[model samples]
Target chain A: MLTYPKTELNKVKRGTKRAVYDVEQINHILDAGFIGFIGCNYNGKTITLPMAYGRIDNKVYLHGSLKNRMLLALIAAKEASMTVMHLDGLVLARSGLHHSVNYRSATLFASVRKVEDPEEKKTALKCVVDHMIPDRWETLRPMNTKELNATLVLEMEIQSASAKIRDEGVVDEKSDLELPIWAGIVPLKQVAKLPVRDALLPKQLKTPKHVVTYYKKNKT
Target chain B: MLTYPKTELNKVKRGTKRAVYDVEQINHILDAGFIGFIGCNYNGKTITLPMAYGRIDNKVYLHGSLKNRMLLALIAAKEASMTVMHLDGLVLARSGLHHSVNYRSATLFASVRKVEDPEEKKTALKCVVDHMIPDRWETLRPMNTKELNATLVLEMEIQSASAKIRDEGVVDEKSDLELPIWAGIVPLKQVAKLPVRDALLPKQLKTPKHVVTYYKKNKT
Candidate 1:
């Protein structure tokens, strides 16, 4: 299995047991979610913002308006990091100190650059939209020249990455196990409800096959 | 309504219509979620990590092992920022450019300091645990002196804050309305399953009232 080299930047310090450096595992964590918290330095303080992203191989794509401050800062700095997490469950323990959460999280450090080539930019945009919902870009209206010009696309070539996963039952002190308090795991899931069609659409138009498939796979 | 003053640090530049500065609205966004993405500078590169947080008025609390590198970085910086977001739905549009998510998100810039007072430290820790689930701290075994001392608690006093909310339906270009593509919202929700009791717990001990209440409120 391919794994990232543990550097000072991507090493997990506090929870060494939960730390993961394998590339496949980190990619799995990233592919499970579409939104990522992107960190950038702004006015001497680091700030994070959520953005939709897509991954192909070792590169992640991000797009926004040309005037986006955070994206501009990233390009100026030439390096960036994004983190994604999925909360699986809540771990309740007999003691307050032992309480924890079941989660899988990944952080990627990458070099940032603008996607200037038109064809590459278009492919990146499609990758991003398709990442949100598989086969979504095929049915959508194609981007016009004006729209394409106004958009800013960024390419992040991942340099180093790490992941952490905790998927276990409660762990409490030996003495606290016999306490009268209840303890267990409460599993959490992000599910989808029935789709609501836009009022502008014709009543006769039906939901597409991809939409139905996504709903079936994601619904509670 | 009380609103945070517009400043360069917390200003929302792109989506002016979705920007919210009202204190009550921002607090509502903060209270709806427990995990926040905290940004910190590491070796000249900004990194974001998910951390459980609790908010009391304008102050946010975070705790971890005393040796946590991220916590120590925040203390060294003396100022930090956190971003919390709740994804509400997937907004599929006829044009890929219009595709977006219905969400409520808040970002806070704060001055950070380590909590040294014993009483305040205990209170902050309780707040952090209780924020995960209401009334959880009261039922769990209290923390011992060793545990308390081994923990590092940081209090972030909010200096500026801003929120963005988008709860409306699909907004597509007028020309794309005639297209046959599917357009609408797929509502997303984070829900809890039935609690699983720890194997060590006596079969006689029942799930607590707070856990049941939390489940009832969050279940699909």
Candidate 2:
């Protein structure tokens, strides 16, 4: 299996046992979520913001307004990093220290570049919209030239990445196992509720196949 | 209502209409979730990592192994920032540019200081635990001296903060109202499934009240 080469940058030092560098595993974690926390240095202070992203191969795409500060900082720095995480469950343990959360998280270190070509930018935009809802982009009104010019599309070529997954039940001290405290897992998930049709939508316009399919697959 | 004083560092530049500075609202956003994406400068590169946090009054607490790189970096810098976001839904619109996510997100910039007082550290730790599941810490086995010594707790005093909330339905263009496209919102939420007792637990031991309560309140 192909794996990202570990460097001092991407190494998971504290939890060595939970760290994973396999490219496929990392990609799996990335594909499971569309929102990522992107870190950038603003005036030498590190700040993070959540943004929707799309991944194709090793490239992750992010788009924002032309004056978006975080994206502008990334462009100025010529590098970026983003982290995506899915909270799976809560691990309740007999001991306070052992109480943890079950989660799958991945971090990518990448070089950032603007997608200036019109065709590539269009593809990236489609990738982002479709990433949130599969096959929905084609149904939307295409971007006009003014809208295209106002958006800034960035492509991040991942260099090294790491993922850490903790999917097990609680690990309390052996001595504390017999304690009367209750310990277990509470599985967590993001589920969809009933869809709300827009007020402006025509009464005759039924929800499309893609919308119905997404809801059916995601609803609890 | 008291509100956080916004500085250039914590200003919401792009989505001015959605910006919120009220302390109560920002705390509500923070209290809705325990996990936060903390940003820190590592070797001159910015990286974000997910960490469980606790808040009390105006201070936020984070604890990790003494060797955690991100925590250590925050200590060395003596300042930190973290972002917490709760995704609410997918806003499907008739145009690609209008596609967005309904979310409540907050960002905090703070000065970081290590909690050295044993009593304060214990309180902070309890706050962190109880934040995950209300009233959970009192039932767990208390931390031993060794465990306390091995953990590093950092207290972040909030300096400036801002929140952005988008809880509305789709806002499509007036011209696209007659289009055949389907536009609406697929509401999303994080929910809990049934609790699974630890395999090691005695068969006679029942799930505790706190766990049951949390599940009942969060489950779909």
Backbone clashes in model 2: 0
Question: What are the per-residue Cα lDDT tens digits for candidate 2 across A50-124?
Answer: 999999999999999999988988998999999999999999999889989999999999999999988899999
lDDT of 1 by residue, B4-61 (tens): 9999889999898999999999999888889999999888878899999988999999
Q: Write the per-residue lDDT of candidate 2 for residues B112-140, one digit (tens) a residue.
A: 99999888999999999999999999988
lDDT of each: 0.93, 0.93
lDDT of 1 at A131: 89
User: Against the true structure, candidate 1 has what lDDT?
Assistant: 0.93
Write model 1 residue lDDT over A82-186, tens digit each, in one string: 999999999999887898999999999999999998888989999999888899999999998888998999999999999999999999999898789989999
lDDT of 2 at B10: 86
Each model's Cα RMSD? 0.8, 0.8
TM-score of each: 0.99, 0.99
- Residue A36 of model 2 has an lDDT of 99
